[model samples]
Target: MKTDVEELTPTRVKLTVEVPFDELKPNLDKAYKEISQQVRIKGFRPGKVPAPLIDKYVGRGAVLQEAVNDALPELYGRAVEETEIFVLGQPDVEVTELDDGNQFAFTAEVDIRPKFEVPDYDGLEVVVDDAEVTDEQVDETIGNLRERFASLTTAERPVEDGDFATIDLVARIGGEEIEDASTSGYSYEVGSKSAIEGLDDALVGLSAGEEKTFTGTLVGGERAGEEAEITVTVQSVKVKNLPELDDEFAQLASEFDTIDELRDDVRARLGRQVKLQQLSEARDKALEALLEKIDIPLPDKVVEEEISRRNQQLEQQLQMAGMSKEDYLKDEEKSEEEFDKDVADAARLAVKGGFVLDQLAVQEELGVENEELSEYVVTQAMQMGVQPQQLAEYLTQNNQLPAIVSEVLRSKALNLVVEHVTVKDESGNEIDVDAVQRELNGETGETVAADDTDAADEAGVDEADTAEVDTAEAAEAAEPAEAAADAPAATAETAADEAPAAEPKNEGAKDA
Candidate 1:
């Protein structure tokens, strides 16, 4: 076999391949066998038909076509391996020659990774905000803790802010009610603004047994974004009573014996969270700096595909949240043109980042061990709320292990860059990346790690809430991996993330 590569562009190549008849023999034989099993003959069984007889009946051209179709992929792979070119996307293959008994030839035009040298990332500097926990933040955290344990009692007065109200809502368009948008026995918190617009304003100053009509835009359902006249009847109003922040309250709410001790613990927890935010910011800023140091031409096709994918993902999320594109744009304060430009910019950055990291991984000879892959799978499973075995099975069935391995390799490459880079807080204090990593992993003794549910309980937060916060943090930390799982424009990209490990069933709850 002979292979030659022609550079069509810096990011694309055309490969010409020639193979001797012997290399095509195996595929031809296999094709003959397969055709024999499908064709019927008078004296021979299905599997026993001779190649000559079948060829006479089925035609040699058909056999050749079948074999060529089966052989092209392998042939193309061989050509790629021989030329050592990093191809992207699928190749546009055309069989140029088929000299029946002599040789086969074909040409493949495909996009490829542009060859570029990895820039030195040493001494790269990024500035992050100071990890400072303020008194107000601590107070707010403790206040939320108190609210979680607050007792609700029936109130005799009219509805007001912070009051828990039990009400029935009927939504009507042009005086005709929309059943899906109407619900009874609904519990709403006044001033929460979690429901449709104008609900809170109308609910306030209304007493029990009082009904009021207001105009609001529906947030969900098929009639989302449509204006509707909502009639809300308040059935009951309740006042929330928070326990006093004293020794007795501390004992009831947390393991701490005194309010002062509880406050101190809350402050420490806040401090840890602040450090985590700082670290996350630093990682992002460091990546930004690294990207700015390298310039690589991106394949237009890859960037366009990435942009389309991001738009599709965003559309899915907006649909799930019952928001329209216009609503989302309004909320983001961006025009359609601006939103499109942003998506394009983000797509280019993501594509370039993937290319840079992949090259760096190659340059550094980084590899993903089985143990490391297993650990990453487990972490991702936890974040996705699925069992490790189940996620593993899904990945295997989808042939996504290579993408996962690539993701890990890219991560290691980025971590190497981060390690060599200089990160400092606003106050010019040099941050210890290793120490921060340890603390984030729950190795430091200074404060309880984000994953410690027991510590959360001691600090007057529910174990479930703590777990939720930890899961959110983990998800945020794994965004790049998640993006890789969703994207397919890069070497490490996969579309498997679009398929769920398990389909979720709706529990049939009405939206408020």
Candidate 2:
């Protein structure tokens, strides 16, 4: 067999392969054997029919076609191996020649990963905001904790913001009621504005048993976005009573014996959260800097596909939220043209970033270990609210394992880049990204005091910190893959030859 490659473009190639009759014998024999089991000869048992006899019965052209169909995938793969081109998507294949007993030839044109230099990523610099925890932030965190343990009491007064009001509400169009939009005895915060429009404003200044009717638009249901008459009758108004911030309050809310200890724990937790946020920002800025330094040409087809996918996903989410594109654009304050351009730009960046990181992974000899993959799967399952085994089974059954591997490899490559790059805070102070990561992972020599351990844990630091860290880690780990999710399927195992399937051996034979 002989194979030749033609450079159609830097990102694409055309391969022409020629094979002599001798190399075609194996596929021909297999095709004949397969055909024998399907066709019944008058005197011979199934699988015992001679090839020549079957050829006489089922034309040699049909047999040759069958053999060629069976051989093309393997032959194409061999040509690819010999040429050693980084093919991207599936190839466009055509059988160019078939000299009955002498030679066979075909051509395949495919997109490929363009060859480019991955520049030195070390010394790349980016600036992130300082991870400084302020007293106000700590107070706010503690205040939220206090609110969690607050008590409710009936107040004989008008409804007001920050007060929980128990109300009965009804919605009607021209005095005809909309059942789904109406509820009885629902409790809502006056300032939350989470319910229908005009509901919050109407609730204020209303006492118990006092009712007022206002016009508001229905946000969901068959009459969504349509205006209707809303009547809200307040059953009662209750004010939240927060416990006094004292040693007794600390003991009641947490295991801490004093308010000072509780405040200290809150400050420390806020500090960790801020640092994690800083790390996340740094990853984004570092990646942006790296991309700016590199030049990579994205395939137009991949970009277009990604844009379409993103649009489809957005449309699905908006549909589930009962919103139209016009409503979404209005809410986002973007015109259709601007939104379209944004989608296209984002798609191109996603494609280019995938390509760059992929090359970087190769250059750095990065590999994904089983443990790493398992951790990734588990983390993703947690975010998706599914069991790890169920998610793994779904991914495996859908042939998505390669995509997952690619994602992990890209994540490792990004991490390597982040480690090498110089990241500083906005105040020009050089920040230690590694130290922050260690602290988040609880690897630092900092341990909760034995007596304060349960108190601190009960104060909500460990749980909230764990959740925040998992979120940050998941976002950083999955960002690349999520961005490139719609890029061309580039894994070798999934690069199907796209050759045509075999034809029926004969008219009277079962389909092969």
TM-score of each: 0.84, 0.79
lDDT of 1 at 198: 90
Question: How large is the C-alpha RMSD of every model relative to the true structure?
Answer: 7.0, 12.7
Candidate 2 wrong stretches, greater than 4 Å: 40-44, 53-62, 312-328, 378-397, 442-512
Give me the candidate number with maximum TM-score: 1
Relative to the true structure, candidate 2 has a C-alpha RMSD (angstroms) of 12.7
Q: Write the per-residue lDDT of candidate 1 for residues 353-432, one digit (tens) a residue.
A: 78888788778877666666666666565556676667877876775665676677776777788788898999999999
- The sequence of per-residue lDDT tens digits that candidate 2 reaches over residues 1-512 is 89999988877789999999889999999988988999988999999889999899987888899999999999988997788676666689999999988999999998777778689988899998888999889888888777667766789999988788889988999889999889888877778777788898999999999999999999878898899999999998888777799999899888899999999978877776667667767766777788899876666667677777778778777776656788778877989998898778777776677787787877876766666666666656555666676777787677566677777677677778789989999999998887767665573333321112222232222332322112233333542323234334332211112222223211221111
Relative to the true structure, how large is the alpha-carbon lDDT of every model?
0.76, 0.74
State in Å the error of residue 1, model 1. 1.5
Q: How many backbone clashes does every candidate have?
A: 0, 0
**Ten contiguous residues with the weakest lDDT in model 1:** 493-502
TM-score of 2: 0.79
Off by over 4 Å in 1: 442-512
Distance (Å) between predicted and true CA of 420, model 2? 2.8
Best by lDDT: 1
